[model samples]
Target: MKTLGKTILLAALAWAASAHAVFAPGEKVIVLNSGDGSISIVDPVSRKEEKRVPVGKEPHHLMATPDNKELIVANASSNDLVFLDPKTGDILRRVPGISDPYQIAYSPDRKWFVSASNRLDRVDIYHGADFRLAKRLPTGKVPSHIAFSADSKLAFVTLQESNEFITIDLGKQEIVWTMPTGKQPAGIWMTPDDRHLLVGITGESHLEIYDWRARRMVKRILTGLGAHNFVARGDGRHVFLSNRMANTISMVDQQTLEVKETFPVPGGPDCMEITRDGKQLWTTSRWIRMVTVVDLETKKVLHQIPVGKSPHGLYFQSHAPRQ
Candidate 1:
């Protein structure tokens, strides 16, 4: 009787774990393995890697369609965009001829699709409907990240190699302004109010806040070494930043521009995804080939999920807000 009771207890615990995630049949988490040129589809409920899906060469970053129907993976070396079914991780289609698309995004107004050709030092703008190239503006060396104004008329880009930041007038397809910034600016984000832009300086230990309207940097917020990337907590009040070199993730209050919580995570942390309920934080640990999962409620590193080499970007169908 004791043995039977023990088995039932263990089974009950397992059910709770799966129930908490509430994953459907095809629901899974997608991770971009940049070094291996593939993607890992993991079962979120079981937290086990389901399969490795081969994709284009050097798959670096990914994002969902503005309508959230499909997920797009940017393959830099292969110069293509592969669209995947958001729920099942199946390849829907591939659009080729995108030149060195290291990072890509769609503007807030859904009027433009933008790609940064990192290796070619160019920013390519495409018509939202067909993704036909509207204009390719030559930028400083290594255009790394992109953000857009709420109105979708102004697009901001960071040049890592040139240590500069620039804004392009989408209507004219020309760079209206360019200014110097700290070394190695990688990830760029706009604040909730869309008044200021936050730049992650990968070569330093802090981030620079730029007032795009005033055309000047307003302040610097010291996060940690190699502070890069931002993901909001879905509450619209908090944003998380990952410090790759420091192996830490900092949660900053957007209103105060101050970090409220700092949690240590092993391996070089890169891209992040938080659960919809805002209880768990998932980040790709760049160096260790592992995805670090943190229990936000307890502020503890739960466990790391092994994936592919040099995992860079991560996403799931049910996740927290980006802004």
Candidate 2:
């Protein structure tokens, strides 16, 4: 019955649509928080702006429900999360009372959402489907970003104030480990195999590669300048780190833990993600209101489409890569 309902809905959309569009499979439509109080939706295929909706002030990261039916924007200045209809750019609802909310992460099972608050030094875990606050998990000073382990058993949050990563055991709902990193660790990513966790430190241009099983930082890969947020390729073979100061994306070899390529991007590449088929990579320039799309194979900019002001975090839905 659920499948039938989806089919019927797709049929209705097809009947109403004008043309067949190629959507990047597993490629999520990324919304950029243009600090000017607007969210810009980027269509990866067309390399064009799909929609721009007015939002709250200083919107940072965004999270979509497991079903992808809803997208929530973390409005840092407004101290709320604004929920929206992903397909139609409609404001559905808003959850309030968060202090300086920054990055957002979903549980592997997509049951819960944990959003980090910079001013409050806490993470608010929300019921994924309902957007209800389930638990308030406390952390160290200036919690920056959050990443969950592959098994979804643990969550690692980077604390900027103390330069440490706090590991939270999801099952027990407790802090199991705290690993220290360089100054002002900002963004983090768990490898595809779930064996290692990569942390990007802002104060220093370094990538901390931690062996999760070993519970320690075994290797530190040096980046060019201002290594901030990052995303891994679909194949998990390479990781792209957004070097904000250098205005480039540094492709690091996951196996060797070495920088393989340093490609130029727009000013202040804050966060990035790859298409599901791993054909194109997209990054949002923080200083500029544009989304830079890079062709993975040729390593060239295909488009620099305008978005909202001060665009920050990005998200992509998983889909079959273009053949």
| TM-scores of all predicted structures | 0.94, 0.82
Residue by residue across 1-323, what tens digits does model 2's lDDT show?
99999999886676224112335332336565647888776655445677787888888887666667777788988888888776545689988876667788788888767788887888777776666777788889999888887777788899998999998877777788899899889888887677888899888878889997898889998886788887776555877888898787898888878899888887788877676657777788888778787877888887788888788867655532211
Best candidate per lDDT, number? 1
Q: What lDDT would each prediction earn against the true structure?
A: 0.89, 0.77
Backbone clashes per model, in order?
A: 0, 13
Candidate 1: lDDT of 259?
Answer: 81
Report the alpha-carbon TM-score of model 2 versus the true structure: 0.82
Q: lDDT score, residue 216, model 1?
A: 95
Q: How many backbone clashes does candidate 1 have?
A: 0
Off by over 4 Å in 1: 1-19, 22-25
Off by more than 4 A, model 2: 1-30, 42-51, 97-99, 316-323
Candidate 1, residues 108-191: lDDT per residue as tens digits? 888899999999989999987788999989989999889999899999999999998889999999999997898899888888
